[model samples]
Target: MLLLSACGGSSGNAGGSGGSSDDVLSLALENTLPGWDWRKQISAGHVGLEWRPVYDTLLRTRTDGTVVPNAAEKYSYNEDKTVLTLKMRAGMKFTDGAPVDARAAKFSLEGFRDGGGADSLRLAGVKVHVVDDLTLTLTLPAPNPALISYLGGSCGQLVSPASLDSPTLATKPIGSGPYVLNTRATVTGSKFVFNRNPDYWNPDDFPYDKVEFLVMADETAQLNALSTGQIDGAEISLGSIERAKSTGLRVDSFPNVWSGLFFLDRAGTKIPALGDVRVRKAINMVFDRSAIAEGIWNGNGVANSQTYGPISPAFQKDLVDHYPYDIKAAQRLMKEAGYADGFSITLPEVDHYNDEYSAIAVQQLAKLNIRAEVVSVPRQESISRILGGEFPMFVYKMPVNPEAEQVSNVLGPKGAFNPYHSEDPELNKLLAKWTVADGDQAAKVYQEINRFLVEKAWFAPFGNPDLPWAFNGSTTISGTLGTTPPLYAFK
Candidate 1:
């Protein structure tokens, strides 16, 4: 899920090669939150650590956006384009050594579908079919070109039967992934010790002996520890990139699949300002995304033009380019919408997005004669309020997905994330066509969708930012060419 799959086709035999248990590795991260359950919601911060030794999937996209096989050894598409048959590798076992057969994969797929959670919408139209122990097929209600791509998303990560052995796999998970969870309790808010699986299917290439994840909120605290050698690497805040570089540490910045915005509550009736489409467009034009990307972000980020989509090639074509910065256009739209004198709206800020970005957004809105009230709150409280439809327009972050299906799930009018209730009939028609086209044809359709979103000013894209970091001298960092994906494999 971290941009690409590091997995390869099976060489021959499957299972562990008997490595020493002393080879434990440790990693450090800046923040943490309560949603560790992969089945519940979409949170990138959790997936960075939680994904390592916990979940497995059928295919993975590398930093270059190339798909690679993970759990499935061989796969084939049917003539009708409705069934996806995958042949599982033999001799593979879970952490508990329970047989990771086709049935287990089928159960994981079916469990997610019937879970009836927000994530269920991603799998709603698909049906799982078990052909045999080594082979399984995914049957879609219609011809879905995004099926294989969906298999590479966070939602497609395979879960083990042992994960269900306990009632709370959210915190204490048991998986067959490359790493295994070694800690049982939270240090600050869920800390884990990740040891390279001796039984991991591919042990030769996974260089890290062990990995550790500490979930703390303060980015400055993370940087402070990295300076003192308490942590090796951390995500630097937008304002701290140059300072991190000044310390002679290695800085890695990439365009992450994360975007922040003020989501208007479409279901709410009280806030009349949000009902107007021009108001949203005005909001998009107000913020100088380029300035935010250059000054505050230290050239580490990009201005995102489209709100509810991924930055990857899989979904990028469906995204509209840059948002118009002309304040006159914004003013015209506002006046035509009958808010010529400007109006005030309150926005509750969620901490997951950059705080500076939210404050700047409020200032930008003021330029368009629109007053925005900023209310800072904890991440969980903000999410609860937003989900309950309390705020008219509130700050939120949408994590990037490398697949197009994830986009459909978030942006499609009737899809799960219909928060704005964007009922663009043309977009709906294109999405339907996109869901069933071949890879090449899908890309073309997405290109049209992208142009449409841009023309409508659906969501502004701030440029992708660089993610800075410092690592041990032994670490080797390389960037894949002509792509904006974020994935790294330690050698």
Candidate 2:
């Protein structure tokens, strides 16, 4: 995802409403808003486009990878960076007339940390304190470089304290955002309507008078809606790419997700052969990454040496060539590790695409004397199996965060997705240093962690998925997807 500017993409020259009239954009969301409280969720399924109109966050992250105060006007931190302070603008009132003060913000943030489902991880060790009407402080157990980024992400969106008191808050929320959910035009579970907030703080920034969110999980249905002018924007499936273009709808494409093979036996506790670094390196060297990327995904994605996005600064082009496919080298490594006859390994796959990945892997590993057998497991049991060390290797999709903290968590021993149960003490110490480091120090630590993971063959990286977001030609979008956690602006 792009660490985008507040102004997303350049505006289209296509003559349309130019955001006059109601400027009510009917956007299709992948899932229904299970609840209205931002604490429960701030997005449909973490894309966060649908959550913008109803709430705002403390900070807004920019394309230049810097953060500017949004609802917050000023901020400070202690010498050690464990305690952070933020000053909110005075007189910022919610649509329901409650003051958007430090106390209220504290309550809102606490609600999120206590019950934010998946997002609870973002504020794990942080404690919130109301200093005064304008001042709020966040105390962290450890230094966090991405705290500001997290506050500007989906987890950062805040709701009004008054909204939480409402019995119908799960369906209707009162917020300080630029729009109010209009029940008159809304249909439960199918469609939602948001009328403009008359007393919104930054009225000039919000061009639209109304915005509508619809649960449109079907790509074909979203396409039909776009043609009929029923919706203005929707997330499109890969199969709908051509149809969306044929309809003249503008498509915004970004790095979707990283799908690759993960090594779970770095310690070789379950798989003794994998304890040898040569054996692990051999596994990474066996696959022709270029062929796997180009042949399997076609133009949908580009071959990536590491799991990080291509645009990320952490990506080291210099080291990408280290693991180029060489059958002779792979065989040598295996034989050096006393596996000249190859070894039998079981790989678990949940999805149909991964099943195909298994097939290709089996064909390649056979040549190197490694017999790879794939076992199909139900998708629901995949995570448990991974955590339980049921498989030595598995095909998986890793979400992109574009932040050091995310990678830190994933590569660390305490990470929720650390399926490998990786417990390298040096790695842990490096991560601890990375966690506290700032700017140049942080960058240096991150690069080391990123490089270490790749060099150790922790993951056999593949390519980025090309996720295309379809929008009607009538709307001129100025903001990019996956930018600010709240909402993209209308150009």
Q: Give the winner by TM-score.
A: 1
Which tens-of-lDDT digit does each residue in 48-89 have in candidate 1? 434545566666545544566667766677787778787787
Per-residue lDDT tens digits for candidate 2, residues 1-491, read 11222432332222233123335556776555556767756321323555667777887755344676778877777888889898888888887778988988898788888873545666877899988899999998887776776676555676777776799887777777777888777897777778777776666666666677777656678788887777777766555677788988887766735667777778888777777778878877878878876676556677776776666656677666668788889889999999888878898876422554777788877877878888887543454466566788777666555455456446755453565657777677887787777767777787787788788777777756665677776564443433222355444
* Candidate 2 total steric clashes: 7
Clashes of each: 37, 7
Q: Candidate 2, 175: how far from true, in Å?
A: 2.2
Query: Cα RMSD for candidate 2?
Result: 5.2
Which residue ranges in model 2 land beyond 4 Å of their true spot? Answer: 1-22, 42-47, 163-165, 238-240, 255-257, 262-283, 326-401, 412-423, 474-486
Query: Which 10 consecutive positions of candidate 1 have the poorest summed lDDT?
Result: 13-22
C-alpha lDDT values of all predictions: 0.59, 0.69
